[model samples]
Target: MERVEPMTLFGYEKLQAEVKNLKEVKRPRVVKDIEEALEHGDLKENAEYHAAKENQRIIDSRLAELATFLGCAKIVDPSELDHVKVSFGSTIIMTDVKTDEVFSYTIVGGSESNPDKGLISFGSPLAKQLLGKEEGDEVVIALPNSKKTFEIDEVKYQEIVFECD
Candidate 1:
């Protein structure tokens, strides 16, 4: 299996929990539902039985995907980050020159990003642009319409310890 890039401890735990839930709780429940539906008679005309079986297949597929990710996961702690240069688990403050808007974002792992919560993935265009930049540095990012310039107001290494899925 290919290794997952920069997995957090929290992310690993969440994935494990999801796998457990799917296997222990969901899988059995689905099996029981399918069994009950099968008791209703001919499966050829049984929508409930087919639907339950389909749901089980989906759940099993998701479980397999999660297992693969977990098998390849290597948990990394943010406190281990030493490079001051922009990288994963860094909080960056920047000012958009064109809009004169200031914002702060925490660069996180790809699996942990919640854009609405101000956590951006390192793979994001903005994060890519900010990478390797320091405070007072300026970077121009190519947007869909036009290039946007941003001035780095601050760069701080953050050891992210709290996460929710």
Candidate 2:
């Protein structure tokens, strides 16, 4: 059985949008490309046909993946989260014990992790260490390179809003 994973509302909406685009726009475009390529070709040496087929395969794979993801996704409402302890969808601020560098990260599901944007997967080392920890709690996290200590400064849950493109 596939485990149902928690996803923020924004993440769920994003996945839905991607699925729509793939089915509506990309699928037809690839089909057209394949048809046009078929008209020009000897099957064995048709580069355009081969390329279109490969693209179709990729789109089909992604569509299946997205379908599975959406099927098992549970959208988490930020307003329902407890602010006292860190958990999935919690935005946390922590200060490094050694360098005193402070950083903020939103703990999200694995599918929505974007380190560059300060979104960390709930299963990540740092998020795992922070889970169930409260503000002012000190914790140590071991990374691939080194072990670092941090003091939890704050934990809050805020609704994530994604701008439609």
Question: Highest TM-score among the candidates is held by which one?
Answer: 2
After superposing candidate 2 on the true structure, give the runs of residues whose Cα lies further than 4 Å from its correct spot.
161-165
Clashing pairs in 1: none
- Computed on alpha carbons, the lDDT of every model, listed in order, comes to 0.83, 0.88
Worst 10 residues of 2 by lDDT: 156-165
Per-residue lDDT of 119-139 in model 1, one digit per residue for the tens? Answer: 888779878888889888889
TM-score of each: 0.88, 0.93
Per lDDT, the best of the predicted structures is: 2
* Model 1 clashing-pair count: 0
Among all windows of 10 consecutive residues in model 1, the one with the lowest summed lDDT is 156-165
